[model samples]
Target chain A: MEGEIRVGIGTDADLVIARAEGRAMAQRLGFRRPDPTLIATAISELARNLVMHVGHGEIIMRPIVEDRRSGVLVIVRDEGPGIADVGAALRLGHASRGGLGLGLPGARRLMDEFEIDSQPGKGTTVTMRKWRLRDDLERLREKRQQRG
Target chain B: MSVAILRKGEYFIASIQSDLSDTEVLALRDDLIERVGRFRALGIVVDVSALDVIDSFAARALRSIALAAKLRGARTVIVGIQPDVAVAIVQFRLNLDPLRTALDLDEALALLELRPERKPADGR
Candidate 1:
């Protein structure tokens, strides 16, 4: 990850905790500080989802940048049962189990871009990207805040 | 990284001094379990006053340590969570569910009102 944060974790939810450490290390190394908070937060939710739904998964964190700037990309993949309702999962106000009612939605909310891939008994891969030091993206984020 | 132990009533307090990273956390988890495995303390309060940041690795290590202590027949409590940090956990929605949180060392110790240390020959 050039300027983005990257991390990998096991299927076990307990092991997924390493995601936070990864973000912190990235921030310490000067990749991005503010975004790591959201990245780590989303990463934790995805990890919990994997443990709760898939039962096993891996999280890979890397940087995503257009030019020579910095950003964070989190990829959470699982191998077990897959989601049956991708649309419902992405709904702004949906939840599984008892989370902030956010997890997937919240993940999408906190990042610059979010994508999910899943199938019936196959698995799921969630790719989320958040960029720091990007002016246009930052302006769009500010506009979102204003709208909120 | 180091853990300083203290005696409060019947519980022993462990004050950690380090970042509590993965390697350090694993060692702390094991050593605390081993030390408290045989002790007959009514409870053990771990003081984290020295730590500035605790991530999932540290939290899991704390959770494992607590569980290991429970298996050893002693209650475990994590004490002294800074308010700012707690806010961060919430603001970022950091998942510390695996680990138990406490207000301070006093409350943690008071939760058990630990009894006096058992004599070495008593074979508790």
Candidate 2:
């Protein structure tokens, strides 16, 4: 089964709503307690960036299942001025405007897999995936049993 | 908006029961600062037990509030940070080291009570 939710980011209230929606979606997708929080935090960072930089943006959260693994995927898109240096932006403690500077790297570290694409004059799209740890452990156990 | 700042003896307690947006966080900072001055509180306890997620903006606001309270002769303690939230903060490389933290509200109160009387020369 696949499910998706879209949230528009325009103001600080939108950030809170986005976080709540992201957390709820992750939970509905069978993510555990902390995983839901992580997803929510990532969404907050992205939403805050959208409001601060682009003035508006969109966040899409979806559930995915591949092979025997299940996970949640988050996509954040913005039409703001794209990052001039993707590598620098991913570095910790690097703030472009004026904040903690944890927006991009922090989101990356919170998820299992992260990818970003940006064009100087166009926009930026961030895609992140977090796999279900229980499923991964179960798959590992199955592999061990098969080998034995 | 439901966050309440209560005065308990010489300490002020601000319990955040819901998710706060960036604007609310800023308002909280201003409110806390004003209350610290008005009540002449000696200590402040910020309870974030109900917050499932705290982004960089919220975290920074909390830190700034703590600093502002300190300048106003009030000690600040942050309590009820979830383990998952702690992990996320560390992963994000957010520095909350300057702020005093406790596991829960009870511990925070105990810690504040145990502190020696504020020295007049103890600036910062």
Docking tier of model 2: it is medium
Candidate 2 Cα misplacement greater than 4 A, ranges: A133-148, B116-124
Which candidate leads in DockQ?
A: 2
lDDT of 1 by residue, B5-110 (tens): 7666556788887535445667767767777755666577778766554443355567777777777777788888655445435554445654555798657656
Name the fnat for model 1: 0.00
Residue B10, model 1: Cα distance from true site in angstroms: 3.7
The number of the candidate with the highest lDDT is 2
Off by over 4 Å in 1: A1-8, A11-17, A28-38, A67-69, A87-112, A134-148, B1-7, B12-78, B82-85, B92-124
Model 2 clash count equals: 0
Please, what is the whole-model Cα lDDT of each candidate in the order they appear?
A: 0.64, 0.86
Against the true structure, candidate 2 has what lDDT? 0.86
User: What TM-score number comes out for model 2?
Assistant: 0.90
